[model samples]
Target chain A: MTKLNKKEKELVHLLKENARLSSEDLGQMVGLPSSKVQSLIQSWQKDGIILKHTTLFNEEKLESTHDTIRALIEVSIRPEKKTGFDAIARRICKHPNVIDHYLISGNYDFLIIVEGKSLQEISSFVSNTLASIENVRSTGTHFILKKYKENGIALGTEEMENRILVSA
Target chain B: MSPGFSHLIETIPSSGIRRFFDLVASSKDVISLGVGEPDFPTPWPAREEAISSIEQGLTSYTSNSGLIECRRAIAAYIEERFGATYGPEKEIIITNGVSEGVDITLRTLLNPGDEVIVPEPNYVCYAPLIQLAGGKVVAIDTSQTGFLPNKQAIKSAITAKTKAIILCSPNNPTGQVIPKKILKDIADLAENHDFWVIADEIYAELSYDEPFVSFAALEGTFPRTILMNGFSKAFAMTGWRLGYLCAPQEFIARALKIHQYSALCAPIMAQYAAIQALQGMKVVQDMRRSYEMRRNLFVGRLNEMGLDTAMPKGAFYCFPSIQKTGLSSEEFALKLLEKARVAVVPGSVFGLGGEGYVRCCYATHIDLLKEALTRISNFLKKR
Candidate 1:
């Protein structure tokens, strides 16, 4: 991978902090014209420098009925002839319960993060859907107990203290 | 209802920067680069600790100096980070903010008509606070020296009546850090001339290019340096009203008396929050990293738009020369605000040597900064 220049790295960092920042603002920050900043952002998106923009919901603040259960499931898989773990990983990820799946270098071939309405639902999905797959060898499930942080933001029940509109 | 105010209070000019902030507050659809504080909220752990402390009924007033435990944390933090040592009990007095710390230190140290060498363009509060404390402010213009005061200029400004020199590193408005060699020279001059060094290191943690050097940590300068710092800039705790003044035992003892009669002590809950902040330097580092990115972007953009701005080594402000636009600093700032709805402080508000520039704070949301810059660019084009 080619290393990003200082400005590009700063652009990435700023976007990471607040992706809602407009092109004009990004331009002002990195010393580029708005047109130039827009083009650069386009190229970044095209080149996979920017994968996707997503919102970070403060789940604790929301009034919701379902308390979702999330677990990290480490999967040891039997490699197929040509595709190795890719085919099996794709099949497992096709399940709607799988929020994220990553190929790994550890003892396990894949680390998958799965979420469901309840612990029983996740367990049944793992047994009926994930384990029933042909290439699946074994699985180790570790349920999340608490979320201290997510998406570079702290997950907490506390509301942010209101700042003065302007200060010196 | 019509009681007369003090003559001294009447004479002191209202902060020009605050005037712009007021204008910003009242106006709609305005993108303000006028504020000096950070955009980030205080880190969660610190705020959480403060809430918990209050819930646990730790709301009583701390000692005149501050909580001993908080003082100890500050002492260890200073020693570990900046290689400076001070006894937490005798050398540090927690104040409401650096504002109060500066106020009381001057009141304690200065007699009437004593001169204080203040380098400008600088922070707005220093000169007025000097006057309020009965000290004559001798402002040495640092415009020609990249906003870093040279030793010769400082020495030339000093006189027998000179009581102290006020220094701000990673300075406000200009965002320049004094070079270490020159700072050392200034320290040496303080030693030879027997003047106090009041170093405002509130922005110390925000330095981008180099590790911040505490004036008190310098050889032979520890005895004479009054180092002031707070959680305002670094930990985004401005509203928490927590700051400290650290000096020699005798100096602190005198300053403590002034603090006792006036503000008494910093907020107890805030002090507990500060202890948590000291424990959580990682949060400070994260915030500093964000500020560094913003600094580079803001400074670079200003320069690109034909405004000659010094790359800020620390702090979140960028001082951009508006002379090229053929407008007075105030005229340029007012025009920008009136036409573009983008608010920035006229640099002259910071005092002498500041007339040809404007101070743009980059601590706002990046989107607002971009919109402000776009408006500024359009305004410049029309000009």
Candidate 2:
């Protein structure tokens, strides 16, 4: 029912392909003036289709080179306090660098997977940032020692098939 | 936008295939044969062409109808490949993918309370999208006819409120192709009954042994058919989101208004790459040969195992009955993943007629096919 007009559709198409495109560049891509592009972006921001503009940084390039710091945290709450827990989880999720978070099952009220530079950063965040919140009682952290795969694909052939590790 | 925001959204069903894939991804050590995409990378030349187009500042928007040269190339390619002809300028509308083309066409054609007679088990999108368009979907199960719609059943399914019938050849779960005679019969039915025929021929070029017949290509059916297709399957350009709708000039005009509003146009770089793909007929032919090989290998082995697969006349999948194993298709698929470590789609995901079957996609490596079949054999043995 929220049908995008021609210009809005053009805006969405550009954003879907490259969220990094500058408003001026996006305008150029859709044959609109720079000012018009800025306006469209503003409207899109309000409409929520252009949910947020953020960088998808190359993790290897970050100062925290340890990929092992990645952990999935699950928190469980009482059934009656589901709304309060959800609010608390949403607050944690607004952090600038959080990758993905989900509301999941089996003993967990919330599942938060965040990438950190080191275990200390994660520990400090849990102690100071996460634990400080009200109605947040328990948390489980699983340090990713080796990532056989990430996202929806295998990281390498070794993940797809069991291959013997050859040492030099 | 309106009071029915939640209600309207709540009525449409989420994609079953998408849901299954998410579950499989979360599970451990599952070798997925569930994905419908070709495992092959986008052809180097097409990739290079797209990269160069961006580099040369050809990234700017083309007309809403799409790049002129691309549209012309599509017209020429369709004429040469399927013997269908249309004016590229006024009759073609580029879309994000065949999914979007299907979505836009339904939304544009259906008024409130209109009926869409869809043949099942078929692709997952048809019914949900039609409902989202404020139309009611009347599903006609095609399982009894080996996934091809019978003339009598289709005739019986139609009513005065029936506005259109969605036809998917080389169908999703069953891989059944409507033969020329049957195609013509359906076309004649549409003509006599005064209903639109939304022909989804996305797998047109992927037809293995049998030839594909486009609904628009049939004599006297051109006026009422809206031909939908995309480059994802045939050209291995799934990520690019380049698809199009070819219809009569009048319908194209109306659809373009919706297209212009909903998607404006497809990606500019993808359109440029499609121009290259059209020029490169060899690329289409090569992919066809490989998919045919994969389809043949998987289906052939399944039959040898006595899995009872109906001959898949087109597309790169085989729907084999698992009734002998004494499990529902969902149960069979879950057991296979947990035991054999191979992931496949349960046929029920496609809709009503697919309950006892599983759709195994073979658009993967030959070695993977062999391994999956071996796993299948072992799973059957333990039962």
Candidate 3:
């Protein structure tokens, strides 16, 4: 694959920052026509260079009363004959409650993020759903205490600033 | 009984800005697009330096010409950025702000009946300042020529009484930067007509389309060009109120006299801050890049909304024609404020050649800009 040009790379970074920017807005920044900008973005999406345009909503902010427990689980698993950790990693990730699952090195073979309604619900998943898997050897789960920062935004501060309204 | 105000003050025409802004100020939840300063806070290094200087008790008033180190730093900055040489000892005077620099330079150069040519739509302060200095203002309307000053119009305006011309590029209200070719023609006119050129380069660092060309740097023009600049826009240090006036020693000598009694030096802290602000151009470059992006986003959206805004080559404003809305500039601004709850300056407030448009400053967050544009689009749709 060919490397993206400087302007294209900058457009990509701008999209990553704010995917909702209109093609007209992107064209203005990248010095291209709206059609050109639209085509560039479309090509990137076709090539799988751009995964998706998504919003990261802080669940805590979205639902103040509703509680959702998020836990990170580290699991040890025996490698299968041919497919290695890929088959078991896929199986662990297929669980409905798993938010994120990654095959990692060091102490654990797989690092997974699980979301559940309660501590008992998460503990049950760790004991039953994860342990029952054929190659699963051992597992450890850690509940998140808080999220100080997420998606590069610091929480608990008003984004809008009060400034002098007008001058000449 | 109260004494009457000075006749000199009466010569300066009334400004509608104060009254108009009062209306905006009285309102709630109005998204203002009328600001003339950068939205960024002062860069950390400059603010840190000022804080340190204050902590060290550097609170005494600087000399009328300001601190020697600060002047030298400014001189170096002008030299590096614009390729203009200036003597730090007598050629530089730090003023309260570029506004003061404008006042002092006008006072130093003008005599009674002297006519100063000002191109419009331009900065809001120049015409009144010229009048207050006992000089007649000859306003040249440049809107017909892509908002760039016309050489023939300027030449015809020149006469025996012509004393100076004030040029601001990238200009306020319009965000139009006079191209190098246009500036050179004006330089030649200044040389031939024997007039001073008061260049308000306060917005010099904000020039986007091309590198900023200092009027003083053109051949043989340094002697005639009184260069004005400051950290207010570039460093995002508007409240610091630090600006520098660079001119010939003779001009500076007289300007120093007026500055000495009228304002003295700029604040000691801001001077110290300026000394650090000039130490690195990284912050300035970063801010300029952001402004460039904002300019694109704002101008692009304005045009898409059918406002017919020309691409601003520099500064942080986008002047869009409101003639299509079947509203005068003032009407558009006032109605937009009332209906859309968006505040902007009417182009007519900028003087002649500005009646059909409105100035929307883009030195704001992109989200706010988008929201303002959306609001304006809706307002246009309604009417």
Candidate 4:
């Protein structure tokens, strides 16, 4: 993939800070004219460098994260001869509390993380949902006591860590 | 399966807000500033009405456009609130919340290769839905103008393929309300260019500052505007899955056709309850006042923490710039959650212009907010 050029990179940086930024303010940030900034953004978007604009919510307000417990669930499975694993995965994904789950490699057939109201709820799911599956084996639940970072960014880390860190 | 099922489904990334909450949910003892729903329960009157409807056996489908009473109530409410008028029979169609309203409108309006003008730092749904509809999205970054769209950018982005523009006021992520003058300008452009305006004003009722003006409120502009709103935000009815779309009679007629085949109708019990919600403004007003208090306290603490937070004029979110920390928004969010056990969303999750900022919702309890603030300050100092 082609890296963003100096001006383009600067435009992306400003936009990442506030997607609602005006082209004029964007130009000022990138040292370009408003028209140039607009054109540069248009070009970058056309090339798919800028994927889509969105809103990042304060989920804490939703009380969706109130109990804040992370547990990874592993399910061992043998696919019912007719119905495939994809169908089962989709069924499990439909559960509201299953935030992120993946069909992974190696020993564990599936790696899942869920948010539940309590430890009992998590265990109930493991016992009822996972254990009850026809081709299922026993599962392991790893409760995440801490989350250092995710999506390539570290929270509470110094700003230096966020940079690319080009060596001398 | 649709021909492009994989391609279509893969296009929209999981909401960054949801991702942040995932991290927040991991830490058992964390104080969170990452939620977006109202703190209040669904208004008692509304809940009672829904329960009564169910008790009375009002569970069958009403109509493709939804119950007549609900539509009339919506029309009356909009007229009373913003002087926007619509013929309930022809101009209104209730949907399965604003989420479906947005999804259905984009699906109905855009064609492959069409372009949509979306003001950034707005709602997360607009862009992805536009993409799913096979329309190209042109985002006009609006952070510089106090989170409002620039008229010049709107004009410049217009092309033969421009299908519509989406306006969200008391906007999500950034709580900036669209000024009436600016809205008029946008309406003028839409009129000149012959493109529709899909306005999502779900937070109009919870605005803390000035009164919100509906794009449909402007005379002659109603024909080209589809106003989408819901009871979820204001009434604390997120689980209800009910909303309504008001557009020109012809468009509603068309949208209803698609809606009828798609969702059938908003949940019957929820629709019955929504009717009661509209009839009771006093309850809505009380909730608004409470949100106003939370918004003030949350925004105030963010500013006091030395973060450059924009004082939100409406909604419950405060978009604070964390650039001084020299940390990218994601890094700040992750570290704060892990080290301080306080979770807030990074700005980059919103879009291209969201890098150096983080969004914190004031809808949480005051004690939680204070604790989150303490963790935030400590994290900043250590950095």
Instruction: Compute each candidate's TM-score over C-alphas.
Output: 0.82, 0.69, 0.83, 0.68
Q: Which pairs clash in the backbone of model 2?
A: A75-A109
lDDT of 4 by residue, B1-383 (tens): 65666768787888777766656665778666677677666777888988898889878988999889889999899998989999999999999989889988988898899999988877777888899889999988877777788798789889999999998898878888888899999989998999999999998898777888888898789778999889988877877888889988878877887899989988999988888888778878866765665565566666777998887888778899989988899998888888898777787776657778888777765556667777888888788
* lDDT string, candidate 2, A53-110, tens digits: 6654444446756453777777665433546556766788997445677777677778
Task: Estimate, for each residue in B123-220, the C-alpha lDDT of model 2 and write its tens digit.
Answer: 88888899889999999888888788989999999999999999989788687888988889898899999999999998888887767888878889
Reference-based lDDT, each prediction: 0.87, 0.79, 0.89, 0.80
- Docking quality class, candidate 2: incorrect
How many angstroms is residue B15 displaced in model 3 relative to the true structure, after the best TM-score fit?
2.7
Q: Write the per-residue lDDT of candidate 3 for residues A41-155, one digit (tens) a residue.
A: 8888899888889987766777763488989999999999999999888888888999998888798888999999999999999998999999899999999988788777667
True-contact fraction per candidate equals 0.38, 0.00, 0.55, 0.00
RMSD (CA, Å), each prediction:
5.3, 22.8, 4.6, 22.9
Q: Compared with the true structure, what per-residue lDDT tens digits does model 1 show for residues A1-168?
A: 758787788778778878887787677656678798799889988998789998878776766824888999999999999998888888989999999999999798899999999999999998999889997899999999878988656677444334554455
Stretches of candidate 2 exceeding 4 Å from the true structure: A1-168, B1-4
Worst 10 residues of 2 chain B by lDDT: B289-298
Q: Model 3: which residue pairs collide? A: none
For model 4, what is the alpha-carbon lDDT of residue B139? 88
Q: For candidate 1 chain A, which ten residues in a row score worst on lDDT? A: A157-166
Which order, best to worst by lDDT? 3, 1, 4, 2
Better of 1 and 2 by lDDT: 1
